[model samples]
Structures are given as structure tokens and as C-alpha cells.
Target chain A: MPSPALRVLTDFKRWATPLPVWSGRLHAADWPLTARHIRTQGGRLLAFWGEDRRAEESAYLVHAAFLIATGIVRTEMVVDPATAVYPSLTSIFPNALRMERALYDLLGIRATGTHDTRPWLRHAAWPADRFPLRTDFPGTDLDVAADRGYAFPPTNSPDLHEIPVGPIHAGIIEPGHFRFQVLGEEILRLEERFGYAHKGVERLFRGLDGAAGARLAGRISGDSTVAYAWSYAQAVEQVAAARVPERAQWLRALCLERERLANHLGDLGAIGNDAGLAFALTQFQALKEEFLRENQRYFGHRYLMDRILPGGVAFDLAATDIAALHGAGRALETAIGHLQEILAEHGGLRDRVVQVGVVSPERAAYLGLMGVAGRASGQAWDLRVQFPPSPYDRLQVRMAVAMDGDVAARMAVRFQEISESLRLQEEILRKLPDGHPYHPLDLREAAGEGIGWVEGWRGEVFFWLRMAQGNIRHCRPQDPSWTLWPVLEEAVLRDIVADFPLINKSFNLSYSGHDL
Target chain B: MYRILREVLRLGKVGEKPPRTQRDPASASPSCFRHSLGIRHVDAGSCNGCELELNALNGPHYNLEQAGFRFTASPRHADVLTVSGPVTRHMAAALQDCHTAMPAPRRVIAIGDCACDGGVFQGSYAVVGKVAAVLPVDLQISGCPPDPDALLRGLLRISGEQVNS
Candidate 1:
């Protein structure tokens, strides 16, 4: 029973023959060694290639790695002035195809030995030659008319019928196109084409100063606002060596848990609603409203956006607020217990969800899934438990896990997580340290790269912030949606197209988060 | 009839319902709203604030379907075009085409601060500022991403339903 981090690190240390030393700065020389290090660390190879941005003199090769045991991630970049193409990781990791193609399309980075070079993320709307992420590229001129119709993969057989669900869905959900190839009721293949909501979030953060950058991060995905803000703050804070007060850390955890609880409650309710259980929807909606109202009463925003800043939290919780939070937590616990009882007794709801949209434990492990979706499938990789950056470490958070890998399993994980979050929130409120919520960090302009990992309601949210001369050079906000979206496709296999919504809702991966 | 009576008896005492008159009027519309919106949402390259708020609109607080605002599966069937994010280059055409596909008398609601006016990503290289830059927006709900309540109000306004406030 070694700690998850230690187990992962130890396995990785053995996997790679030549170990690489920790470099003070993420420079060009460290790329190869880092890649080797990641491979030895039981990490699934994702992609490796150079990106030539005309704005910078030196070109760089970006490498993505997904660690298996702990779901820890490492991305390496090396500055290579020479035009040397690296071999593709597709042979080693089949899933690297989509990511490699996306990198190629967005950054004009070429990957040698890569089998597929089809355009992804770059629709016909943008000039085929122009790469938007590069600074030197002129902005897209909207005045010109371009072909808007997308040619999806065509299925000729009568058995292979296509079901185009949305870019606009029946429910009030964000837009994304899901084209299902079904054989009668069972789905044979599911292809998702999104960017209907593509808002170049990464490129938007390129030039903003740290303070302004944090605000943009908070809005990355509204439900995960606290998680994104904290991750962005963690990156900046680490780069600046800024120390957040213990109380601020505790308060950050409280906010994160509240966000987690709020989302889980809503998700549980929505999952039920999707299953045609109106009673569950009404009950859960009422609970969720009360949950959000409590958030508004304490934090100015119901979603807790902008509550977290670079140095510390934007606002401090008063004693009265803490008392109110505790009271709310108790009430939530009672309500959740009652809801669980009802869910258990309702055989109709149980039958609909149980064994529906099953993602086997093996597949979940292979995909490197994270968050509640991964946990439900028995991959208990939680950043709070593994990384535990300060308050979580002190609080001793325990992750909730289930092995069924189905819609019901996902719901159970949500229920258990809500309960766990309530307990954690109470603990945080009870032992909150007394001090200023923020301590201004007199951060200087220096080039540094730091990784911020936070267990958002959607699993692990990873942020990579690179700063040069007091301004952000690059920011990568990786949501678990990147991993889970594919899993949703796999889970829907053998299920009818009509049941897709129920299955999809159970794994609620964020389209905007992925599009970013 | 006997089975129906037995089923009613099994459902223990129903909790006190909120006063019928005092209940939020916005929550009383037919539940079929999700079937009607024929919604086509476009992201004009936002900081993602509007998108989050858009997500909140679907969540528990103000379930949009309860009020007759549903998201459609395609632009051809949509009655309203909901655009969020500051209009960006990658999405400009899709945004326009989605609007064009919808039949006449369709309403366009810009749901977030970014969609209303680029909000934080106002002057970014990738952003085209506001949704108005590319399309005719009928309603604007302003908040970095408006709260779920504010989003609900904006949708209600578009549906020709009066807001209680």
C-alpha cells in the first residue's frame, strides 16, 4: 500500500533505463531525457513533434505523456533551431493519432512516421495553410465566404444507419455534433465533431499579465471555475515561489469541495432526468438550488468564479459564514441520505441505469481516465489524494471508487463523492485557520514553467503555465474531457442511439473544456 | 383504478408544496421546452465564462427545459440561436451558417459577457470581440458569464415571457 505517487514514481524510475535529472528550467536540452523518463515511468506515449511559430527564433518539440498508475501527466518541450522531425508515437500508442493530428493542424508541427495526417480541429472554415495558434499568423478574416458543410464519414450499408443528434441538443446543453453509426438499436461507431463552441481559449491567454490571466482561467469552464482558478493560481504561485497562508489553502479546499458537491448533485439529478425519472429530477433540482443558494449567500457568485486569485483567495469567509456553511453541510448530508434511500428502492430507475453503458475496468485503465468517471470504472486516481498540495494533505482526503463501470456506477460514485465532499467541507470549516485570506507575492518577471494539478469535479484538471518577462508565454489547460470523451464513445457501444443521452449525461465530459 | 389507488397510498405523505401563487412563475411552462428551442449555439472564441454559465443554465438551479427553452440538435430545426464566447476565426463560418439554416423569426440570445461583448478576451488576437460582430443578436445577458438566474431571465425574455422582477 505505497502512496499512489510513490508507487508511480518507483515504477517509472525502473521503466526508463537512463534516468534524467530534474532541470531547474524547462529548456531544449531536457526534452529527450524527459521523454525517456516519462516512458520509464509507465506513461503511455501520446505525441512528440516540433512546432514552428514564426514569432520566436527557436522552434520547439512538444511531447505529451500520460502516467498510468497515478494519472500524473508530464509534457516536455525542447527548443531545436534545426528542422529535425521526430518519429511519431502512434506505433507505441494508437490513441496518439487524434492528438498528433490536432497538434499538426494547430501548430504546423509535422510528425514523421505518423500513419494518419488527416486534419483535426482545423475545419474547412479556416484557411488550410494558416495555423491560428502561431503568433505570426494573421487573424482569420471572417468577411470571406468559405465552405461550412463538413463531410462526415459515410456508411453505405442499410444496417449502418446514421443518427445525427446535435450541435444543438433537445436539452439546454452546450453545442457539439455526435454522429452515431448504429446497427438497428446498437451503436457500431460514434464520431463526435465539435468546435461549434471552439473559443481559442489557449491563444487568448497568451499575452495577458498574471492577474488578468487568472480571471480568464476561472471562466474556462464555469462549473469547474474554482478548480481552474486554483490550478492557474498554483502554477503562478509556484513560478513566483509565492506561499499562500494555511487559512487560504483551507478555504481553497472548501471552495473546491463545494464546487465538487454542487456539480455532483446536479449531475446525479440530470442523470436521473435523462433516464425519464421526473421525481428524481425534481428532488435533485430542489437540492441543487439550495446548494447553489448557499454558495451565493457565502461567496458572491453561485459558481464561485473569481473567488480565487493569484496570491490567495479574492475574499475571506467570516465566522458567521463558516457557521452557515456547516449548517448547510449538515442539511445536505440528511438530504443526500434520503435521496440515496429513494434511489435504492426505485427499481425502475435502478434497472434503467444498472449495467447500462458499461466501460469495462480494463478499458478505463488503458484510457488513463481520471475523476469520478475513472473512479466509477475502478481507476481511483485523485489529485487530492495523490498530489494533496497543502490543505488536502493536512485534511487527509480519501477518494471514492466503484468497479461496475456503468451508468449506475457513475451515479454511485457521484453520490459517494457528494457525501465525502460534505465531510471534507465540514472538516475545513471546523478547523479554518485565522489570518488574512491573501498575501501579495512581489513576483518578478522571470522565465519559469510550473504544473498545476487540481481534482476538479470532472477529474484531474492540469494547467501548464510558462512565463517570460512578467507575461504569460504559454498556458495549457488540459481538462479530463480530453480523455473521457473517447471513453463515452466506447461506453455507448451496443447501446441504442436513443439511450445515448442517458449514457452521455452519466459521463458529462465538457465540450468547451475539450475544445479549448 | 384499485392499482392506481394503491400506488397513491404507497407514496407517503407528500411534503407541503410551495404556495401555488408564490411559486416562481418562470418554472411553470410546459416541460416540452427542450423539444422546441431547436437551439444552435456558437462560440465566438470566449474565455469560456459564457460557456460555463451556459452549462449552469442546464444544471439544477434553473433547468432551462422547465421554462420551454430547449437546445435543438441542428440549425435546420432550431427556433433560436444561442451564441456564447467571443466570436473567433475558427467558428465564424459555422456561426453564420447555423443562423442561416434556421427558419425565419428565430431569436438570437447572447448568453455570456464574452458573447455580449468580448468581456475579458475582448482584444485577444484570436477573438473577434462580440457575437454581434458576425450576427444579429436580439438579447444580451451581461455577466462575465451571467449567473444561471440571469441566463434564465434572458431566455424568458426571448420567449416573450415576462420576468417577475
Candidate 2:
């Protein structure tokens, strides 16, 4: 059965009507024309990638963008022999700005006629001529010298004071610098300099075969380990067209929801704590601890690391474990419901979150912002509802959206998602089918590229993997944080600097995710 | 406000006394001082796995403060410099600078395998191997991310606070 996306691509010319997703390959010259048409139809660029296949002059650049309203994911391929730079889509889709920059950093495929040509992902440490993602770019044992500093946008105003924070912060959070140009307490501009946590994650993917790559995928961002791991597995399986057992599919969904629960619980509490309310912190953290302990008891690891693999999951739910999880859900529902009421009535907390860090629906869509934050900002594009996998397709997922786009909206989205996840978890346990949970991948499946997308707790976690000769050829794990981090700089604009922490917590963008 | 008071009252003090890592630290290592372990954490290039476990340990359950484990903001005030990740290039200098900021007799602890010998990220171009590659690590707590309890145990042992049976 051809995918609906593929069907839409084939039928693009036949019908005058716009589909949710319209995708197909295009000639290098026709790229701009196709992109313009998509833009006119209100499509947004989700991800742009250049695949550096060193296999005898047959390399191509791939672009995947979403037309959200119709749930369309149009995929296009480009092959160039001369100046491999394609027409700049950033002129059409603003969100493609950083992704296009990263393309050049990785594969030397510059977006010709693009607005900004600044080095992204790769900093001064890497030499100008060296592109790390090239097939010949031996990623091992690179001796990098910190040769230069980043070219941050110049602050021309003399009245504005500059304050640089992080890469190493006051709290136990991850590293990523933020440069704020301000007047008194209000801000004029905020610039975020990430890639400080860049661990050569994409480069490391080449060192492992399919199974081991799953491990690296999970490690891409630990909080979204389940999402990344599942995405990676789905990509590998899609290429192989492997038949995953019904039971395993259900179990994978179960793990995904548990991950969603754990993160939402933690973030809700953290957001409250950041707003100067300590009571919410204790209650929520305690509840999260209970959730994690149950994860450890059933799944063998608290964070569910290495639990997901190539064709299926590593573990199956035991009879007693399912019963226990069901019981835990009931307890969690009551506890969360009680905590939710307290947070709703708390006036001080409400004031801090209400109008602070507002990202308009227009800006959110322009940035291609996703996950809970996107939903909070009135973007009703949840992959589970739009383009779901096997188990999720069967389950009814209510897409939550709020127009306010403030910290309050974000918190409200999390609350609603938590309850939804709990509901899904109980339903999954009630209807789990019996079969083998793990299927070993066939070696013959190592020749083509496949894309895996999952709506992780932080939003959408996407992975594009191409395997050849029993090893990964090119792997690019796109974290939703890359899109949302830029919005944080936008979100914190004009707000007093002190409220940065609260705003930051509401979005809770991942440095590792973007840096990777 | 009343809810806050009642919650705090119910969740009183942490139950256990600080586990004595050792009967005495002065005898084992004359150069070291052990009492309150002020830890300064530097995330060189981790997946945020170790940090989460650390957060969990500090929260109501493990109660890191009860065990005399505290996370300090400055290396100057810290006795142990706890570092995680593969020591990414951008962070290499910062890690060295943080180690430099600590006065003499300061302990360096590498948390997670990524910090130990680079773990899964050892050969990657962006990193400079491990924590020991850039700093003089006294103890290495191993695991993709070592369990928070294991990390606490490593600290007590390295700080000469672990009571050897």
C-alpha cells in the first residue's frame, strides 16, 4: 500500500485542489518553483537536509516540508554536479534559515541566494574547508583548535547594556549561551548561541551499525530518548518494511506515553517552581518520582534508556506489571488532579505566566515551532493526530491548542496531555495483543533512506537515516528544539530579564537537542 | 500560604543522618578536607541523562543535602568539580578554566561514561576524549549515566567520606 503522502505526490498535477501534503522529487532548477507553490498553499518548511553520499557521483539533497492544515509532508530530492548549491528556500520559508546554514556546515551544500550565510552547528573550531558530513570526511580523531569567536550581531546602540549568560549557568541545566542587549530591565534583543553541547552526534552515527545506531539515537537527547529511539527504529523498519508484532507495536506506544507522562510531570512542577511557588515543586516532583520508580520496576531503567531497538522493543509488559501500572495511573490521576486545582487557583503564579513570553500564532508557524509549546501557541499540528504510527493511528488523540501562547498556555497544554497520556496508557494495557516484542533486522535492508517521526514530549522528534553496506550512510536526527530555541529568544523579547527563567522553563528548550 | 506551611510541616526533615563515607578523612588523606561536599557541576557534552538522575536524587527521595551533597555555582566555592559528557570542543576550555578556578586539594569527579573515557562519544571529532584528558580526575563514576546513588557513593568514597567496611 502506497502512503497517502506518496498518493498526494503522484496526484499533485491531476487535481487543482490542495492536499494536506503534496510531495515528490524535483529537478535542481524546478526546486524554487515547487517551494513557491507550497508556500502559496500555506506550507511551512519542517526540515531541509543535504545527503552527502560519496557513491560515484550519485549524491542528492533532500527537502521535507509540511503543509499542516492538510497534514501533508512533501518530500523532494535534488542532484547537482556543478555548484551543488540549490536555490534558497529561506526566502520562501523563514524557518529554513538555520537548517540551510547547517546543510552547508555538514555537507558544503550552500543555499545559493539565501539571506544569512553564517556558520551554524560548526563554529570556529572546525576549519573553513572541512565539511564533517561528507562521506570522505573521516570523523575520527579530529584535532580542533578554538581559532575564532562567533560573529554575533553587532549592537549599535550606546544606551543598550549587554549581558551574556551561560554555556555554564547558575543552575544544574545544560550549557548554551544567551546574549541579551537591553535598556534598564526591558530587552531590546536576545541572541542564543548554542552548539556548545555539540557532541558530534551526527558524525558518531556513522561509527555504528543499525542496532548500535539505535543506542546513539536514544542518547541524542536523553529526555527524548524513547522518541528518538523509536524514530530511529521506525526509519530502519520502514526501509526493511519489516513486520513488527502487534504486541510490540502496542508496547512501543506504551513506552512513548510513559515518556510523555514522566516529562510533562517534571516540567509542570519545574514551571511552577520557577514562578516562585515551591509547593507545586514538592508535590509534582514527588509524583514524578513515583512515575519513574514504576518505570524502573517494569522497564529496567528509570529513563527507559536502551529499551527501544531496531524492529521492536527490548522488553514486553508482564501481567503483574501491567496491573501495577494501571493501578499507578489511577493514583497519579487523583494526585495530578489535586495539584492542577491548586496551580489554577494560585494568583501569584498566574500573574507571572499569563501574558509573559507570548509567541503569537504567526511567529510560531513561521518558526515551525512544535510539540507542547507549538500547541500552546495555537498550532494544532500533532503528528499523533496528523501522521500517526500503527498503534497511535488506532487511538484517538485529541490535539490541544491555545492562542495565548504564554507560559500559562504551555502549562495548560501539559496538564491536558498528561491526562490524555494516562488515559492512553490504561487503554493500551487493556488491549495489548500477545506476540514476540523484538524482531531482528535483515542485512538486505541496508540500502535505502527512510524517515521516522514521532511526537516526543518536547514535540516532534524526526530522524532521517540511510543505511548501506551494513552501516549507516547518513543519519540526521532533527530535534524540535532547533525550531523552538529561536522562538525562546523571540519569546523573551521586551520582558524583564528576571522573568527569563520562568519563560525558559515554560518552553524548556533542549540545548543538547539543538546542539546535536 | 497555609498550604505551603502544612506541606513543609508534613515533609519535615529528611530522615537519615549523613552516611559516614569514612570514620575520618584527615587520616586517609592529609591534603584533603572533608565535611560539607560542595559540588560544582559542569556539563561538558551529555545527553542530560546524568543531570536528570542528579535532580531526582536531590529531590524528596535521596535527599542529597541530607547526605551532605550540595551543588555550588562557583568552582572557587566547590570542593569537588563533578563533570559529565565527552568534553566537547566548545566546552574544553571552559572545563579547564573551571578546574583551574578550584584551589589546591580540590577533587575532580567524572560522572557518566562519556566523562570517564568518552564512552560512546569517545571517537567523535567534536570532543576531546574524556574528563581526565583535560583535568586530573580523582574518581570516575561509570555508566552511560551512573545511577545517582552510585554517584553519591563515588563522591563519599573519593572525598574520603565513604566508610570502608
Candidate 3:
């Protein structure tokens, strides 16, 4: 299915579209049976599913085109007031089962149609039937035993062995649980049970106003702080119909591109390091540190958190900052050039990454993978280039894509993307609009719903927010990881168990992004 | 000779010792012994902020390996415990088991604002909420998730290292 942003753009191009062309906020009632529809030249459908009380009343939005165009995207929400049982979308999209069951467990919402309603995120630690996310759920007392009652599925076969790795891993990394069922060295099945690090981030937005909510949003994922904050701000602005200053929009794009470059560089280095290529790690690490230090010098936080506010950006780039960025760009170019030369000389590195984890184009399409991973697999659906919003439209963007569908392809896409980002950054610095960084937005407590779509480094970040009585009625930030995580599972199917790390790193799907 | 050249190129001039402030042996507390931390990371449901920064530490730039700290696969072999997230009901037991499995002289370093005081998940129904509620915490590094540098500093502090010196 074409992404929601594309669906919106297509709908905008249609003459017979019933909806007003430029309406920023759409009433929930006016939406189609699917909850929302944008009529463009090819028209697309947006559907909303359910809402959490912490954020908003129950609502689900889906892109019309995503359903009709592909006929693969199926979603359902069962809101049973008595048992609070929500219909499951797993039967249609097997991937949604975990999230749906998790929602059921957390929100006291049950998914009746789900096949495995196993305690996904929920274990025996909490009292049975006492849903934690419910409004009245009491906090747990410290008297609880750490291992009082928890059981993992056992594999008792003579040939088949179970390997339990982590809640803590060998590298300096986030903790997660991976239970690998293997026959001889071949992994038969892999079950990932996370939420060992559940932080209840979504519930944090309970009583926060727009500004306070934005701060919370930035913390949702630290590396993607700029993207989350910008996306949250975009959703809030869209709901309030607030117009961001042109300069702010441009700066947001610049920061996002920089974020993309920094992450890509780090990932590129790590991918090589994982494969025993120490040279790439050192080179990329140095480059990444330099990049982040520049960001810290310009913005308060190295990660650029709280820099992109709701109405506009918090900090404006002075001419000197722009000049410094240009200088940094030149340095990056030189470093990347040297690294590329080294990479070219080392053919062994190429062999390992080229076809190591191949997620065929066909599978990529079926899974609806987006972002660089999608681009690597021949799906070049970039929000910046295809659906240029504001400053992006004025400043052209050329997406980088590769059709190899392998680790090398993903790497190539990142390499190309860094060059493209540099070019775009230079253009933005040169043509930065002459104006104030922000304009005060007067947001009212009226009921309205808006979808904010931004191209985060990972992929398209979709935020569907509804405001009621001056509070966030509902806010759902859909990370592209939701779609890509399953793709990683699919990609690992035929590959060796030893190669899992390389494949997993290639995707780097955000577990936190998906859990929330 | 080639190996030396490669090492020199890989280390570059940036390896000239992380300024004296960052490298002083005195900066490490006399009592601060290098301890193997067995970290139990909870999702408690986050946006992945803490994880990303944590991930960054493993990446080349931060190169956490340089600190003599390594992430172990099992809690049984760990000395210090690191917890992320606001402590959700789902992960509460897992967090505790991880803590219980660790050997003595263990300290818990709560990384991120959420882990510190339910930073964002302050009053959510789904949250159990703060890391302190489930376990005793020795240090709190705040931010939505503290920066990797801050996280490293917190780890050093928990290990009884003198950080700023």
C-alpha cells in the first residue's frame, strides 16, 4: 500500500474530492467507515483503531488507499465496555497480534480474535486481571519476589536446544530477551520477549498540555528525540491548525537530515564492526562524535532534544552556525571519501555484507517496509521527496535508493543518503528563508483530529492525535519499526543463526518505538 | 608493520588519550573496583529514547568497551545492575529476578528520567511506575534518557569512581 502521506498527496490531486483541499483538521464524524480518508488524484484511506484514556478516547484511523490499493492491510479494534475486549487485527496482519494482545493486557482491552493471547508484555509479576494501564490500577509494592513466578517455554527435544540470551547482552546495549530454539546450530525458531525494560512512556502524557507533552515525546526515544519532538509538534500544530514559520520548517528539515546522517554513519560503522572490520568502526565513530559535538555546540543537547518546538524551532542557526555546518560538511566529505577508498580496497567486507541478509524485494513489499530498509529493497517511498511539506517543497530532495535487498544494499543506501543529506544541508544553509524562527501559536481546547507525518531517520513516523477539552484525547505515534521488525524476522528465516546480529543491526528496529 | 599502520590509522590522533580530566587514574575512586554490571533493561513502555542512547554507547563513537565495562548475557555473572524504563507491571518480575540473580556488592544505576522517577510515565495506569519502587537504586542519571556520556558517568559513579576529577 502507498504510505499515508502518499495517500494524502494523491487525494489532494483529485478534482472530485469531497473534502476541502486545505483543511488541516478533520472531524472524526466526517471520516469514512475506515475513520479517515484523503482524496487525492489516486485517493487513499486512513483508518484509526482504538484510543487510550491517558491520551484520548478510542479512535482508529487508516489510509483508504493502503487497504484498497494493496488489500493486505487489515485492522480491527474491539472495544468491549464490560470486558473491554477489542477485536484483534492479527488474523489479517499476523504482525499486529503482539501489539494487539499487549494493548489488551495493558489497557484492559482484550482481542477476541487473536490466536495467541499469551501474556506478551505481561508476566505473573502483576496480579492477574488487574491491568496496570487502567485508570485505577494500583502501583506494585516492593514486597514482590524477583523470580517468584515466571516460566519460559521449554524445548526438551534431544536434538533441539534452547539458548536464552539476555535481558542484558555482551555489548554496551539496551537489554532485551531472545530465546532461540535451535536444532544443532540451525535456529528453528526465535522468540523475542521484551518489555523487561518497559517504561510506561505513553501513559506519561496523561495531564500534560501540548508543550509539556512535547517534552515527554522527545524522551520517547533519545536517538530519535528530534524526530519524536518534531512529529509530536507537527501533530499538535496540525490539530490546532497552527502555521509554523517557513524558517522553522526549513530548520526542522535541516536538523532531521543531520540526524539521519549521524545515525547512518554510526550504523554503518557498527555494521562493519560487528563483521570484524575495526577500521570502519574507528573511522565512523570519529566522524559521528565530531558531528554530534557540532550539534551540541549549536543546540543545547547533542541529540537535539527540545530544539524543535510545536510552533517552530527553539534555536535559529546564525550565519556562523551555518558556516560551521558547511565546514563540517566538507570535513565529513573528506572522511567519508577516505573511508570509501578503504572499503573499496577491502573486498572481504563486501562479500560478508553483500548477500548476507537478503530480504527479497517481494517480501519487502509484502511487509510494507518503509525508510532506508525499504529503499534498499527497491521501495523508494520518501516523504521528503514524494510528499514535500512546506520548506521541503521549496527545497528539492532526491531520495537515495538501492534494489539489492541485502546488508550491502542497506549500506549503499546509507552512503548515498549521506551525500544527498550533505547536498540538501548546503542548499538549506544557502537558501535559509529570512524570517523569525517561530510565531506564537494560540491553541484552543476545541475537539479536532490531525495526522502528523514526518520522515524520521528510521522511516516515516506517523502521529495521529486528537484533542478534546484542551487535553490530548488520543495520540498514537506509529514508528516504522512496527512494520520493519517483522521483516527482520522474515529476513532471518533462511540465514544462519550466527548472521542474525548482522541482519538485526541492518534493520535496527526500535523495540521501544514499537512497544509504545 | 601493516598491523601497526592499521592500528595507528584506526586510533587516529583522537586516541591521544581522552584529555587528562577524562583519563586520570585518580579520577577513579580508590574504592572503585571494576565491577561486572548485569543490566536488566525494562521497556516499562518507552519510546526507545534510553535504548537509543544506550545503543550509542556500543557504537564506535562512545566505544563503551574502553571503559572495562561489558554487558553480560546472564544476570548470574553480574555485579552491578542497570535498569531503564519506569518499571511496568509486566517487567517487574523480570527486573527483580535479574537483580536477585546478580552477585553481591551490586549497585543499581537507574538510567533515564523514566527510570529515575517515572519521569514521563509519572501517573500512567499501565506503569508500576518508578524503578526505585521495584528495587533499591544507587544512582539516577536524568534526561528523557541520559546521554551516553551521562550514562557512562553514572556507571563510573556507581562503581565509586571519581568522575569530574
Candidate 4:
């Protein structure tokens, strides 16, 4: 409610951005202690990643970025190659468990004293000893046998039976495995296993220049291409010390808001369809199609991929384009209003959605739930409002919140967000700045680490990039789905197995993004 | 219900005509699939860009069902398996198993550039190359992610349709 305290004036060095970002180095011994200090001060672990810097230094570096009351605080710790282990923050932030496991799986950097030691990203695609992210290792596909010995933790209830779904779902969706422990119809426990869609995005970004890296980042998650691309560009620009033009910033905001609107429309329809309303799917899909068509007309890509390059946007809006957007926005606003009324009035849909798969605020906080799903559970954290970067700061965005923490609440948030995005788009178009869309970034002399934070349609999309001699050294793109997936597991507890589709659709976490 | 019905009536006949087949005539198809075709889509390891286009085929705009093509829930009921994304090593086995589950004389269509080749992630350690690397691909529709119209055209071509939009 209150504006974040001016800034955390600690020992951390602040980045050269209006957004509050403070970076601090931590001793290996104080890894867990520093994490506890942040946790005690009510900080949320935003992202945790490991970088292999053995060539530059003997030790592997583990970085944890946290969102405290003030702003983002990124802390780095060096892990000795001999030990190859650091203190785990799983107890402090439950979501860090998967990240720490992924760190070990990718870079052979283990997080000691963690409850779960199971592999997260490594599904026996490569040897256990061979870490792909290491400088010495080459990125080559091996014809090895798949990991068939994945052990799902027992819920300690012998009476409950297990039902495993996916890796290949009935619907046309991304791949992920879900194991559910159920008694009759009620689900007791649900464990999700992803990485089936992992295409080694981080490895692919290793040697790419700014242009190529931006393209790869866009593909990290197709649905959130605009967000990923923008965030990647922002990070690259920050590292290159390139200032994007005012018009470019506003245009980027337009692409992001449009992306948010399109996704919300699509998800709202799917959620309604999952609740037994087929009409909603058809109507919403049509609306979403129209929205995307406009994007193609103006931005040149249906999903706005490759539109946000390193320095600025790929395409600029013409007079006709601006007029067309205004027309489309009005039509969309009317359609969305009608759909909202229909959804609100539909009793059967309401009965199916309301109070189903409830993730209480306490449970949400404990699991570090974030993004649209988090806001529904009373996590009043929207990056657009809290730490607005450029155009978002100018937009004065409204944060959407709900307390029920149910499927209805998530749906409500989506609808409200759609309205807000439409409003934002109208404002962006009305006060469209006049300048070149691109600034022509020359990364020949660029050599530094920078962080990019964008409030994507789903939630906050964070990118951490380190450039060395104009090429990407280490890049980490963290999707909000990382935290929300576990929250889905918690939300499904005690709910009927049949309602899983509806609840999951409401959350709508990305498989490729999470897996990557 | 009344509101929905009224809304549907108001937006009447919005479906577009089926796009013409881009497939070569030499690629023969079984006569039984001439009238109707059932497809099962397997996302081996895609960015979900192709999946979005494929999903758009079912919307009111494209409405592939009117052209006698439908997405089946089970592989057993499918005559075509539409695969997307470069096949990840993790999903390679599942993809093969899915192909194995389909009935005889089933065609495999790889949608998007990623499914055709590896696209951007061609040489990644996690990837197992394209759909053809894992399964016998009959058709490869190329694009970063083929548009819905292209996706529909690909489906109809495999089903032996030469219809025009």
C-alpha cells in the first residue's frame, strides 16, 4: 500500500537505473545467513541461478536475487571447486529448492543441506558428472538412455493411490509430467515434473551476440515473447550502456500491454472452457485472434518476437498504425466488457470456478507464489507499480489484487488486468513520443553484468546477463511460473482430480519457460 | 444460455473457407481419409509458438472441423499425428510411444521450423533434433511458427484435400 521505503542503503552497490537494484557479494560461509537476513526482513526470493566462471576464477558463482520491501537485492557467492557446494536457502524460500537442484544439475554446483536432492533439469540426457554450463564441456546431444528411475516422494499414506498424467497431455499443450496422489476423487498430493521442453536455452545463449541473444530469449517462452524479448533487450542495453529513445520505450510498453491483453483474453476463455463453458473458449479465442492480428499488422509478429531488439524496437508505428490501434482497442474494450458481464452472470460457471482449488494467503506466501496467481492470494506485488523501469513509471500503472485466492480470484485478476492493459495501451498511443524506434547499440566495447526486470502478462519476467567481449557469457531468464507451479501443487490439495484442469488452466503456468 | 445463443447468432458464419493444399500431388493419400481426418498433436519440445497456431485452427476463424479435420484426444482415434518443436531427448521416447499408439497408415506432419529442423536450438545438448530424427515425418510445414492458415492447409493436404479458401 505504502510506497517502498526510499531504498535499502546497505553495503550493496546500486545499478545505474531508476529501478532500485542493489548488488552485493557474499562470503561462502555467510550464504545461508545473508538469505536468512533477507527472509527475516520479509524479502521474497525472485530468482536463483549458478554461473560457471572457473575460467575467469577458480570458483563457481551462485547468485540469488530477492525482492525486499525496498527493492531488488541480488547477492552473489563464490563456491569452491573442491567442495562445489553452498548452503541451501530452501528453508528460507521453498521455491529455491528446485533452483538449487537445477544449479547442481546444470553446473555441478550443489546446495548442501537441502531436503530434495533429486535432479531437476537433468533427466539423464547427459552424464551426471558432465555439467553442460561449464566452459570445458561442449554442448553436444548424446544418444543415452532416458532417466527412467525418477522416484516420486511418497505422501506416507498407504491408502491413497497414485495417478500420473502427462509429458503428453490429451490437449495440444507443452510437455510436463504430473503425479497425483488421490483417494477416490479427492487429490491428496500433486508433484509436477517438467524439463521435457528444455531445449538448452541458456547454453544456446552462450556465444550469441546481442542480436542473436535477443532472438533466442524471445523463443524462451513463445506466449510471452514480447516480455522475454523486451527484458532481454533491456538487460543488453543496460550492459551496453545504451539509452533507448523515448518513442522506443513507449512502443515497447505498447507491445507488452498488448501481449498482456492477448494472453489474458486467451486464458480467461480457456479457464471458462475448463469450467464447462465452451462458449467462452470460442468467444475469447476470436477476441484473442483479432488482438494478435493487430499485433502482426503493427509489430510484424503475431507474438511480437524479434520486435524488441538490443537497442530498441524493430518496427515503428505509422499514423495509420496508431489510428488502427485506437480502433482495435475500443472494439476490444467493448467485447471484454460484454464477456465479463456474461461470465459474472453465468451461475454454472460461477459454481465451478468459485472457491475451487483455494490457495490461502499463508500457503501462497510460504510457497513464494507470484505473478497473477500471487496477486489473487493477496500478494500485492506488481513490478509495473513497485519498480517501474521506464514507460511503466510514466504510465502510473494500477496494481490488481484479490484476497479470496481461489480460481474465481485468479479469473477476476485476469479480467481486471485486461481492462488495465487496454487503458494503458490507449494512453501509450495517445501520448506516443516522436523519435527513432532504434538506437543502434554497438556492443564492441560492452563488458559488464546487468539485470532486466519486466512485468510480463503472467508475472514478473527477470533476465540476468553478463557480456564479455560483445558475446553472452552467462544469461538467466527466470519466469514467474517457477514459483506458481509449486503453488499449483499446493492449491490442488483436497480438491477433486477432475477439477485439476480448471484450476491448472486458471494458473496457466508455462511448461517450456519453467523447463528452460 | 440465452445471452450466449444471442451472441452466437449475432456473430453468425464467421468461419473462413479451408486453405488450398500446398502438398505435391505425387504425395499419395489413402482414399478413406478423403472425407474426414483425426489428428493428435504431440509437443515433443516446442516453444509453444506452433501450438498457438495449431490451436487457432480450432477457433471460429479457421474452424478446421468444418473441413472434416478434428483433433483427437487419443492416438488410437487419430489418422494424423501433428508434431511440433524440435524433439527433446526427454520427450523423444514419449513421441515414439505416441506414434506407436496411433493406428496403421497414420501420417506424421511436423509443424513449424523447430519441428522440421532444430530451428534456433538446433545443436543444443537437450534437443534431439527435429521430429524426423525421432519419427518418420510425412510433411514439414516451415515457418518460425506456421500461421493458422498454413497449419490448416497442411492438415487438409495430408487428408488429401485440394480445397480453396
For every prediction, compared with the true complex, DockQ reads: 0.28, 0.59, 0.39, 0.75
**lDDT, candidates in the order shown:** 0.71, 0.79, 0.67, 0.87
Better of 1 and 4 by DockQ: 4
Taken in order, the candidates have interface RMSDs of 5.3, 2.2, 4.8, 1.3
TM-score of chain A, all candidates? 0.89, 0.92, 0.85, 0.96
Better by TM-score, candidate 3 or 1: 1
Question: Between candidates 1 and 4, which one is better according to TM-score?
Answer: 4
Give me the candidate number with maximum DockQ: 4
Could you give candidate 2's per-residue lDDT for residues A1-516 as a string of tens digits?
223434444444221111133446666666766666667666666666767654755765656655545554555666574666777777777667788888788788887887678887876556767888777776544544442478788889898899988778877889888899999999879988777788878778874788789888989889989999998988787667677788888998999999999989989888988899878887777888878889889998889999999878899888999999999999899878777877888899999999999999988877767789999999888888887777988888888788899999999999999999999999999999888998788845477666777889998887877777768877788888877888888899989998999999999878888888
Root-mean-square deviation of every model: 6.0, 3.4, 5.6, 2.4
What are the per-residue Cα lDDT tens digits for candidate 1 across A157-239? 97678888655455556667788998988899998876555566777888678888888898777778899999899888877
DockQ of 1: 0.28
TM-score of 1: 0.84
- Per-residue lDDT of candidate 1, residues B35-142 (tens digit): 245566665555455655565555444545656566666777767788877776566766787788888768788877778888776765545778888888888888
Candidate 2: TM-score, chain B only:
0.84
Q: Could you tell me the lDDT of residue A347 within candidate 2?
A: 97
**lDDT (Cα, 0-100) at A398 in candidate 1:** 79
